[model samples]
Target: MTPLISPRARPLAAALLCGALAFGALATSAQAAFNPPIRMSHGIEYMSGGIGSDEAKLMETVLPRWPASFEFAIKDHQGADFAADVHVTVRDGRGVALLDNVVAGGPFMVARLEPGSYQVEATLRGQTLKQPLQVVFGTPTKATFLWPAGTDMAAAGTRAVQ
Candidate 1:
């Protein structure tokens, strides 16, 4: 019959409950964001992943720390969709391959490279896109490779025809 919480303390209790709920939400999101593990190849370190919304958010958060970042997508009438299983190759100015691998985890990748001129080649559905890039100190070199639509590699089960 009697109120358990005094009128003077009701606002404080409500505020505490709200704060606790907010903190719980924040903890859940922090746990949801999956930060891909950093890998090393030939002394260069890199990480690749952006498969889900939370992972993508985590990727964006660390974009500024890497010297080079690459994003993969496929263009369509509605815009583009993130792509995976892209074969990416990074070459130095002398045409020596530094990082040659396939992105099987996700579509976004960040790499630590010395500031210099480089060549990036990304292949999807047997179609390759090449771009020249210059990585500089104190700046992150960003590149996005977008393939044309209709090249649904998985659905086609073979190389996409021109």
Candidate 2:
């Protein structure tokens, strides 16, 4: 028996199939782009991201599993969260740098580090703030930095980093 389908319809069907496959590949890649990287520190696994609601949600879900976490925020003396471009550095007890040259995209950052003494330094507009933190077992610690209100952050030339 001869097939009843026409040649013209076969080419149309093949084109449609190719288009669908291409769409699927693109969709998968797009979703993967949103996935952030998880880094392991001194036997502790952590991820950092609080730039937007989507990343915030991801950090919220991951917080419970990690024993220690660090958050960065630029707030005025009144304690209002404000956006600012700041450079962050973390050092261990021996003055060895744990993490350096990290730029926060937004006011908040979450990270996990081993339970120990750490020194956190944030630089903004030529002013530096230093804070000492200790991470204990089973207790999730948070550190917040508040920038003075009277100063003008805009003149500092703030920029967001990924």
Candidate 3:
């Protein structure tokens, strides 16, 4: 049997294969690291995540376009730390519940909501915090919910709130 590939082409073929495999791996990892899963509930679209540096950067860039955005944290003398496993609820001005018990997967959340008044309730570790929001067209409404200093947020580590 005769060799199909010339000896001179073997090295170039191997290099090209290796480069293609490396590029595939890099693209896959970059996409996973940067894209947080967007979810839908009760006709509303939302996303929650800001755990790592890359995801946080992605969230910051995308958040402004959302009608509603929320941040969960623990603030105290030691400083502030991001929080997770937060349950959130949203209600319209009439007090009809739109979202109930929607747990956030990370420290930040963004939502696409109609322009109106809303009441948001975020619960963390048995404590619930409530904030009223006014979501308007062309303006983003932001809310931050903070727990007391003693809360254990070891999963998030410690970082200054940006």
Candidate 4:
């Protein structure tokens, strides 16, 4: 003798299967919608030697002005066989400092920043190099400082003289 399931039982099984599938689809969609995308903010690429004396001083004062949790990049020039210590300072349009004392070399120190206009400064070797850099919100920005070989305070002063 053969046995058969009742019509009611068949409907219940079908309903259960459909409910499970719906739940799975909803879970998948939710995960996809909530996932955050990767982003980048600041980068500094140096060529020639590195940050000159003037640039170094500027960076020291600028980096601390940025809000906490910002991305940054620093690339040293490969042509010159010299190492440089680079620093950055960030400020807002109101002349308020946001970030300071950010230092890096080689291909390290990448970070992200909040969306806002910022003034950036860079320094190398205790000398101010570049200042008043403008950083727009939600946009990737960069600052590069080139240091020639054997740059001395006197030489830098003379260049300023010219």
Candidate 5:
């Protein structure tokens, strides 16, 4: 013989279970709707210099600023037998850094940023290169940068280059 739940308690238990299930579903849906506001991508290439020698390396960074998050991609296009490291920095019009790091093996980087204008810069080794970017609130913006081959210690910086 097994004990059974009382008629009065059975309805209460059912109601509570139903409420819990509904709450869980709502929470899951809310999480799925979240998004970022910034996106970025990068690429690299090596160019020949004088005397058939590797001169400068070309590094490219692509940025796509979304309404909720920032996304980006990076690539390296260098000649044979040469590779370069790439770093990226993003700042607001007031020279505030939003994102900065070295990208090695990734298709893109995304971040959440406030609505406004921004500047993006990319660097290779230590030298400073030019890769300006702009971001707008409630909209999307894209930017790209190019670096020459044989660029050792290439460093890049961006600050409200409006």
Candidate 6:
């Protein structure tokens, strides 16, 4: 019996299959790294959301099931979600950094930190809002970091005004 593929085409086909498999592996890993639950040091796990209407809707659905912990919501003084170009840093009372990362595409970030005092610093639109909060066991702690009113999202690289 003769092989269906010509000998000359075997290497090319093999290479394409390997490339596709490699790409699929990388995509799966990257997706796992970002979505559903983001883990941090000291037993802190977080979820990011509200970057779009669809995602916001999904978040609302899961809002009730969110772990009882510290919740950080970013918005502007005008009550608009500050969901663009954001940086978040959470430090414990002893100044130990617990969470330090950029908010890729969300207005809300939830972290289950150990019950204690923490400082949450959120930066957006070239402005920073630092908040002091405490998390208690069995109680939900929420903190909203707000940007100054009339803050220019475009100027902060948060959005491009057309």
Best prediction by TM-score: 3
Arrange candidates by TM-score, descending.
3, 1, 6, 2, 5, 4
Model 1 lDDT tens row, 1-162: 889999999999999999999999998777656867888777889898877677777888888899999987777776667777778889999998888764536678899999999999998878999999899999999999888887653521122111
For model 6, the stretches where C-alpha displacement exceeds 4 angstroms are 1-43, 63-81, 155-162
Q: Candidate 4: where are CA atoms >4 Å away?
A: 1-83, 105-109, 151-162
Worst 10 residues of 1 by lDDT: 153-162
Q: Which model is ahead, 2 or 5, in terms of TM-score?
A: 2
Ranking, lDDT, top scorer first: 3, 1, 2, 6, 4, 5
Please, what is the TM-score per model?
0.74, 0.59, 0.78, 0.38, 0.39, 0.60
Off by over 4 Å in 2: 1-34, 39-46, 77-79, 82-84, 150-162
lDDT of 3 by residue, 1-162 (tens): 877888999999999999999999998997777988889888899999887778888888888989999999988887788888889999999998787789888888999999999999999888899999999899999999999877655645335685
For candidate 4, write residues 4-71 as lDDT tens digits. 76776888888988999999999887445432223332442221111444443333333344322222
Model 4 / residue 113 / CA error / Å: 2.3
User: Deviation in angstroms for 47 in model 2?
Assistant: 3.3
Which candidate wins on lDDT? Answer: 3
Error of 3 at 39 (Å): 0.6
Give residue 86's lDDT in candidate 5 (0 to 100): 44
Clashes of each: 0, 0, 0, 36, 50, 0
The lDDT per prediction is 0.80, 0.63, 0.87, 0.44, 0.41, 0.62
Which should have the higher lDDT, number 3 or number 6? 3
> How well is each residue in 1-162 modelled by candidate 2, as lDDT tens digits?
765767779889889889999999888884565445666544444456555566665665666666555554445544544444566778889998776747655444556777899898877666678999898887877776666654435623232322
lDDT of 3 at 122: 95
RMSD in angstroms between candidate 1 and the native structure over all alpha carbons: 6.9
lDDT of 1: 0.80
lDDT of 5 by residue, 1-162 (tens): 654878779989899999999999887764444211223423211111111111111111223333322222222463212222445566768886655554422212334556666676655556555545554665655443444445532223211111
Task: Return whichever of 3 and 4 wins on lDDT.
Answer: 3
TM-score of 2: 0.59
Clashes of 6: 0
